[model samples]
Target: MRTRDTRSVARAMPWFLLVAVVLFALNLRGPIVAIAPVIGQIRDDLGLSAATAGLLTSLPVLCFALATPLAAALIARAGPERAVLISLAGILVGTLIRAQGGFAVAVIGTLVIGIAITVGNVVVPVVVRRDFPASRVGIVTGVYTATLNVGAMLTSLCTAPLAEWLGWRAAITAWAVLLVAAIIIWGQAAGWRRSVLGERVTAPDSSEAPPAHSASYRSLTAWLLMLAFGGQAFSYYGITTWLPTILHEVQGLDDKSAGASSSVFQVLAVVGALGVPVLANRWRPGSVVGLVGTLWLAMPLGLLLAPELWPLWSVVGGAAQGGGITIVFIIIVRMSTSNDQARGMSAFVQGGGYLLASTGPSIVGAVHEASGGWTAPLIVVTASVLVLLIFGITASARVESRHP
Candidate 1:
């Protein structure tokens, strides 16, 4: 009797799996990036405060923390295929509601999208590990990271005018249509279920899956990773919400120029996100983490001390920080012995990390209100980066898993 050719089956799954992963990634950051593009219109139309606008922008990351842990549990209950499909549908529906206008509705819609994206964020790694077991995990993560960047870049660039032409509500809501397209494509792929264990009703066994390591949350490495991830998120969100306004006010740029400049920062981030993981995979973990951390420290201070040098500094700094974040994600996968631990560790790190992240933009805004200038907030941001550097270095050292 002829034996089954597992190699051919493994090869066939990856091509389609890459497509599905990319679709899922394309929807991941639309909600976050889409808001900043048209935030002013939404604020003016609804008469919301600057602080409220910042809150609206940062709320999704806040929700990400709340919803991420549930992903592992939910996927266990609903199965990966259905879990992701439902999550995408949730994101689509949320985007539709946000387009309907009314500040409360928009916030509510964004919260829903936050929940959906969190699910996707949690599951994609697990799926990559399961679907491409033979491939290098870092490469799979690098592609995932790269596509997510492309998604964010597209939405950030497109959101503003689309809102202006079609009405802010319509432009914001239209992202739902993209989600709908993803859901349809993903559903079609569901029929090829026989190639795997049919979504095994439990998290993938992370113990023997990825490279192994010990993890104890109390370990300095764990604390450092958590702090580094949190600090990065906090700094990133703060930059995203305020950068345009800061440039317009401090640098005398017009509204259009300011927005355009801020968009450049995110565009640079795509390069960072795509580049960091690949490099981390190629180097000694300590050096890769340290170099990325140094960039993180320098970027915020560059924005603070040298406003005149922003065009060059911001792009380089933003890319470094973005790349640092991608490295963090890659480390989570690499440090874990199995997929289940990776997901669980990701949940622990991000849940705590984003809670730390949530404080960043809010505090910066408060500092801005107090000092009546960007100076204080910038100082706060610099200090945050230093903390990030400290933790990032600590985390880069060998660590222990929080799970069995």
Candidate 2:
């Protein structure tokens, strides 16, 4: 009877763990994406300039780049589960701070929020690699990535309506409640006492020890991965930050329609995130990168040539950018031989990638200001997609990581 009960508990653990991870991913993007749809209101209310407003969106990506290196150390000291709780606390605090409604206060809060999300960004891949079977990595990654898109989509779609109903301050603050729930669920499922005690949580295969030095940092393959990841971030953030404004100003959509259109991008992104990995399993993943790159390039060109077909362009762009990120992440995980290596590679990819990507929104905004239209900015996006294609091809070529 005792043995049977123990087996039962063990069998149930993975499902619980999966749910927790999905919920955690859901919380990751909502706070940030919530701002994009209502950014016009924020600028008007706070009396911000275009550059400053661009900075508001770009600041968090900067934090992600700067703070990611520290994540592995935090995980080493506190363990992954505990580190996640700390991240949630930071998110909670940052959300409250941002809700205060001043420009400086919001920037500070966004920085904090970026740092917190960076921790999860580094650690979650480690957790997935550690906990799941090698064959299932793609599927599991898809699940979490899809959940992330779902969160982004919901926040983008709802923020305008929520602000109308309850005001923007309340709309932003409402997401903090998700952090609280995540904390509770993570603590309950992971066991707070065990995590707090600094008990080492080993993978099922205990012989795979942490690497002494991450050789991936020295390898050309890893650099290619970083470039690929950075390109995706550049496209995704650049487009996400500006898409609503473009639709409203350039495409002649109303504010609500523009916001809804932005949500359409994310909704299609969910499809791309979930479906791309499965496709990769069947095809040579490297070949798919070219196709994805073409899709990304077409977005800017489509917007430039045919603003009337924004809906079609948005879906194609969303699918490409969304699937591109997921593919890069899967590549990072596959390149690692163990969880520790995965953590290190994840840090490098996101740290450098985000650092590189942090410039996108600001540069696009600056170009838009200089050129006095969206054409120049869209051309810049097209150029970035070309760079993405170049690096992505090399990154996806299945070269063995030196560290692995």
Candidate 3:
């Protein structure tokens, strides 16, 4: 029999697992993002008002929060691998249903996809924690995170023209290709694992879990970590939504150029996401939190003080946002002693975080409307960074204590 360390090493970099994770990630965000590019088309064709049409996009985000407990429960029963297959299937079915036409069908399909994504969001981190050794968790999780962004970027960039050519229904459903690929590959990997490892594949044992995180919602650590995660989500959504307008209005850039500048934030987030693992390997978790926190702070402050340097702020903030999410997951998985604990902790953190996230755009927009400038909104974002730092460092300190 292999010793624990050898077992850890053998499972650390399995090619099939890596590919499956990549595929899973590639499909995860594309479906949701597909709507953003062709939203007006859907609106005009369906004869719906702006808010109703927005439901196709915004409802999924709400589902991410409201349906999280159910997602956690599914993971608790189905096991991670099977839960993944279920998620992909849900996404595929939902996509097809969405493409069937009619506003009611589209809304239902979007809700299904959102709920399915909530399952993936909760489980994949648990999967990474289970399959990878401690040394590689950060990197693998970063890859997963980065691939999600890639999925959104690819579809966001492509879907508009596809909608023009094929019509919104076909174009929106076109991303089903990703879901198909992910499902098949992950399915094969599942069977292959059963053959080689003879794994029983059942729910994680939570009997030994410490009380602090056993009922994760009641855990102080979980609440603080939730706040940290919320800060990351709030700041990310707010900036991603408004950055282009900020650049255009403040920098006097044209729509295309301002949009291009905003892409700097989205694009560099991959770098930031991938970079977190490298930093995690070298630095203390607390130190990593501090670095990302500073970067997060710099974006909002720099934009406020030196609006002309929007490009610079966008780049740094993009990386910070990527790292922000990656590090938060690292802490969540690191703090868990079992898959059950991981599921519970992740549900609390992510559910609460996304709930706050769903409000970000509206709140920021309201603040901008009330104040009649970006300064107040930026100030609000800066406050969110402080929340991230204080709570992230606090949670990361607990991670060190748990693992050290």
Could you say which candidate leads in TM-score? 3
Superior candidate under TM-score, 2 versus 3: 3
**Please, what are the lDDT tens digits per residue for candidate 3 over residues 1-404?**
55675466446437679899999998888898888888888888889998788788778888888999999999877888899999999999999999797999998899999999999999998888777788889999999999888888898899989988999899998888888989999998887666555544443354545555579877888998999999999999888888888888888899989888766888888998999999998998899999999999999999999999888898899999999999999888888888778888999999999999888878898999999999999999999888899999998887788788
Say which candidate scores most in lDDT: 3
Prediction RMSDs, each to the true structure: 3.7, 3.2, 2.9
Using TM-score, rank the candidates from best to worst. Answer: 3, 2, 1
TM-score of 3: 0.94
lDDT of candidate 1 over 1-404, digit per residue (tens) = 11356455545766777788888888998777888778788788899997787666678888878887687678656766887898898898888877676778878888888888888877776676566663366666767777777888889778888987898877877777778888887886676555443444244553544333334354455566788888788887777778888888888989888877676777777777777766765675566767776776676677777887778867877787677677777777666656556666676677778888877777898999999999889888777777667777666666422321
Q: TM-score per candidate, in order?
A: 0.87, 0.89, 0.94
- Candidate 3 segments exceeding 4 Å error: 1-13, 199-212
The total of clashing pairs for model 1 equals 9
Each model's lDDT: 0.74, 0.81, 0.87
Inter-residue clash pairs, candidate 1: 206-337, 206-338, 206-339, 207-338, 214-400, 214-401, 215-400, 215-401, 216-400
Measured on C-alpha atoms, candidate 1 has an lDDT of 0.74
